[model samples]
Target chain A: MDSITHAPSTEVLRAIVEAAADGVVLCDADGAVVLVNGAAREMVPGDVTSLLDRGREPGETYETTLGDRRLRVRREIFGIVHQAWYLRDVTQESARADALRAERERTQFLVEAGRRLSASLNTRRCARATAELATGLLADAAMVVLPPGGLRRTAWLRSSEAGLEEGEIPVAHADQVPGLAEALAGFPPVPSRWLDPHQAPEWLLPAGFGPVGHLLVTPLPGNGVPAGALVLARREGGAGFDDETETLVRVFAARAGAAISAAVLYQEQSATNTILAGDLRPPPLPVVDGLELAGSLRAAQQTALIGGDFYDVLPTPDGPLVTLGDVCGKGPRAAVLAGQVRHSLRALLLLERDPEQLMHLINKALLSSYTPRSHVTLVLAAIRPGDGVIDLAVAGHPAPLLLRADGVVEEVDARGTLLGAIRSGAITLRTASVDLAPGDLLLLYSDGITEAFGGPTGREMYGSVRLMTALATCAGMPATAVVERLEQLNSDWLAGGVFDDRALLAIRRSR
Target chain B: MDTAPFLIEIENPEPGTTRLTLSGDFDYTTSADLATMTPTLMSRGLSVLEVDLTGVTFIDSSGLATLIHLYDAAEEHPAEMRFVGMTPYIVHLFEVTALDQVFNLPTSAA
Candidate 1:
């Protein structure tokens, strides 16, 4: 195909070749530089044609010098007879491909760090993930420092190193480097590297920190606020961290801080919940002989150990009046209302001299002051000293069990609506007049004691029958002994699991 | 629990009344049971279906999705559906999803 082209066509081909950005060249099969385009000539100048004729294979790359510059040359077969050769310059393309590859690797590292950061919510897990994420993204060992209760001086290190326990680092030791310590004391995600371990103060070196390495410490903020530092280390000879690595570590640290903060909040809330639950449990009251006395006084929900059940031996004109009641519900609301009912009942009982009138006046005040939504059930009994008469009244509560000296268990069924259940409603407080013969005993309690489900069948509740049976056993026991026995039985029935707030009151007629 | 193919029944007696009577737990494990039952009910073309949930004691999101899917499917037929006989806890799930307003919920005291 040896067709001779026109002079204009040859000139057009030369112009097109010169206009191309790539370096173009022509050589003979024997590796002689036959012709070179303007780009190729500019890339490799000084008539280096003698070097190209050294019989190199086609498509083989070779290095050449053009003036003061270095260029890479590749030869390839072109014509049908393979007599002509093509030379191309590929230095710039090679550099661009390398940059693209690096960028892809950095992107992949960031994506993996993000995936690890989202895997766990535990504080320890979060700290470990943060360290691993940092190390994976950069050529460094990562460490996390958290101050106890957000205190800057109290250091807690959660680092990537094995066998490193938190709270081992003293801030005084960490602050040996005033510069590093000061930067951490302020807001974190602090971007700085401390390369010299000797420059790092003796105090700043964590307990047992060994070896020499390049250090990169960044400020980290927990969900509450920026409160810690993420320190990365690259052992000598390891690649120094770049901006891409720093950015990736910082991003992962921020997410890790948020997760740790959430776990801390969950722990705090759990503690608060425990306290709230504790308030519902009735306190261990005085127990002696075979009888026991149970009562509670509530202040408010947040206040520890405040409740409504109360018992005290107060001097009346005759003897002592035993009182017990349950404000519906638990926590602060019950506590507040319990205080009102307790004081009103106490003050009225002392002044009015009549238990019925006292309860009526208390109900009137409760109806006027309290909304219909709130209510409480109460039981009041007046015992005469040296006298056998026991007067009792009930307001929507369990009937007190009477343990007679003759071993007969009598259930004093008294009826009344729960206080506050009705607004301005009158309670016909009937006095159950019972003759407390020698060795007679009475037990009063809140519904929680009876309704509590315990024993072999955890689901089956300990109803009034069980309480009466337990009371019968305390026939001749002292008032204190009676309550102690009941508590033991209740505890046994619970099988070591107490669920509800229980309040029990026991009164005995002194022989 | 075979964990295989199952049937779901959607019955409507009159216009403006739709009933999706379910017979199984509606959770992740039984999601496909409702998936198979959805298209057959859509063919009848009713405007309102009252879901008889009395037979269903427990239901999860898979079951929840059946209702949601039915609700969505009813929209295409231009029908308003209601849920009935739901346990108090399951009704709470509906309230949480904000589906109580979208679907007619039985309002009897617990």
Candidate 2:
């Protein structure tokens, strides 16, 4: 007999079946377990071959219990009077389906919470909504910890499905809020999941929520800083908190903090405006050249002082240097321009001998720096001692009033367009001879004085005729008295304050 | 005219013709709010309308516009409009625009 060299086909087949990840079993006719692989043998406990003689009929379905698992046996008729059976173990697939379902449920819950948060407008309403949603959707109890004297506390607490309940939780000072303190102190947003209730610092847990079974604490970061902490607690029976809840709470808290800060700033500006309007008087002005001069000193949109209308009298070696001018507009910005003009004149006067030269320098200085919105109308005059003659220069300003000793009034006809009004334009100074004999006057006044009205008919202006007549009548009075009378006349002429602030300059040749 | 010129004079009052002279400098700031006398002056029944510029040494564009408005209104009566006491500069402004022909301009004291 040839030594039977039997190939190990059966062993190879057994190895293939045992290597399969799924449990495999082979049964014969009558639905009895005829063969079982390693996986199947290990999965089933009790007797190893007892299933082979079971009284199961051919082509019958049977439920068999093996160890802790349940198996399904199905028999089928093979060729003529032969039967085969297939067995399957379906535990892991069922577990995978359950996990997917739970994951979907958690995502839906987070989406619903986000929608509710967006519906809230103001910070207070948003906070309440956020607290309720967090507690209700996430755990047994939740609290949005606010900054309390630079700490965190459950001042407002909410329970699952219920609104705020009456209770106060001890605050966790900023130094004691566990991971939160670190976040607020300068760490980026942190999400912490605590498996053991007591693992986190005792101060971090709210007073009422004892021994957090599962706590998800996340930092509320705003404008690159941690504003506060959101604490969600889960009791033993509630769903465990996850990353989704942490992210949602974090986003809502950041937006709420920013909105609250902006509202506070708006309130402050409103209060500022009220105070500013109440105390809007003109700024104080300095006396120029023995003239009690006041122009529009109130500030406007651009500069702090109204610049156009200017008046100043500085004492020089020659005599008192008198400059009365306007930079064009009224109000504070014009006043600032007026101040600039005055400053330029002061600087130029030291170097230039002629009034025209001084004005030319001013023009050149303004041309380099003037904005399109600004222009100046100026009249510069220099008076010398022992001479009644005044070197006069005009740049688009009103003529000065020259009062003669015999009560004859002459309007200085010095003609020049306003300085800085025409670029590169020459400043003309016409030498006008006037005898400032005793009792004679030189009055330089702004337009505000002439437009004033005294009577019920406010239409008629306080014309120059009245000014000349008043000047003629008041010529004999002292210089101080003359100015007072003129101011009084101006006040009486207008119903109220000078139609505009009157900048009046009076110079009488003293005997 | 049966009644005094539709005019209310506080400083100086004339007869049938009421004159309201605006003197010194005129500009947008003062011109913004019209005085109540503007309407009252127009309401008066007078044949001669006189705005004495004699006392007015300076006038800005705003003042010139006001005078033009008054002149147009007074044109309804031929002999009613007269601008007197114009400074040389003011006259020059009116003469350049030929507005002197539209209203009676008082000659210089010369």
**Candidate 1 residue lDDT tens string, A173-231:** 55653244643554444444534544654333345556545666666666656546676
- Candidate 1, residue A331: lDDT: 45
Per-residue error for A456 in candidate 1, Å, reads: 6.3
lDDT of 2 at A244: 57
Model 2: which docking level applies? incorrect
The residue-by-residue lDDT of candidate 2 on A1-511, one tens digit each, is: 7798877796797687678654556655555665566666666655645443245666677656565556666555544544545455655654577668766865675576667656644445555665676665566666555444333443443445444653335554544445545544435555545334555555444455555667666555544544445666676555565665566556655654454333333344545543432233333443334333323322223322232445766667776566776555445445456667776777776777577777777777776774533456566667765655566766655567887767788887665544553333444445454556656778877655664545565555676778888888775666667777877776777755324445566777665
Q: State the weakest 10-residue window (summed lDDT) of model 1 chain A.
A: A297-306
Per-prediction share of native contacts kept: 0.00, 0.00
Off by over 4 Å in 1: A1-319, A335-354, A357-372, A454-458, A488-498, B1-110
TM-score for each of the candidates: 0.47, 0.40
Q: Cα deviation in Å at residue A216, candidate 1?
A: 5.7
